[model samples]
Target: MHAIVIDDSSAMRMILKRIVTSLGFEATLAEHGRDALDKMDAADHRFDVALIDWIMPEMDGLEFIQAVRSDPRYDDVTLMMVSTESDQSKVVRALAAGAHEYLIKPFTPDAVAEKLELLGLLDPERVTAGV
Candidate 1:
């Protein structure tokens, strides 16, 4: 499986990339939504999931979700918002905007893994074996 981790913070991107890689995914990092899109378009790769941040320069995660949802090519890709925006309404907005999951920041790797499992992206065997 492959994942695109989009965030303005390099640290956050690295962290997310590490988490997904540990779960058996090839990870790609992006500085923002536009960069993510460009990177996706630049290759023939089909991402299995996208881990996005709500707030960003150029294009935010919400906009990224909308763009991806509108494009048929990304229909099979799961969208997950990994942001510090913990407001109820924000979570609702993200879900309503086509995100498959929303995970607040300051979260552990296990939290991310659990969300991926809930989204049916992670294998139960891997979770069970602590992969």
Candidate 2:
């Protein structure tokens, strides 16, 4: 599976990339939402999933989710918010806006795996194997 990892912090992006790669996804990194969109638009490849940070420059994760969902070409892409925004309202907004899953910052690899499994993005064997 192909995934996009978008965040302003390079460290955070690296961590997310590592986690997703271990889960069997080939990842593309973006500094922010607009950059992510540009990368997606420029490439012929269609991503299977996007892990987005909420408070980013140029565009935020919520807006990115809306933008992706609005485009029919990206309809099949699963969007997951990986943010520090853990408030109930924010979570509600993200889900209502079209994010398939939400993982707050400081998450464990197991948490990510569980979320991916819930999204039907992870292979059962991989999850069972604790990958």
Provide TM-scores for the models: 0.96, 0.97
lDDT of each: 0.93, 0.93
Q: What tens digits encode model 2's per-residue C-alpha lDDT throughout 39-72?
A: 9999888999999999999999999999999999
Worst 10 residues of 1 by lDDT: 122-131
Which 10 consecutive positions of candidate 2 have the poorest summed lDDT? 122-131
Question: Per the 3 Å backbone cut-off, how many clashing residue pairs does candidate 1 have?
Answer: 0
Question: Superposing every Cα of model 2 onto the true structure, what RMSD results?
Answer: 0.8
Global local distance difference test of model 1: 0.93
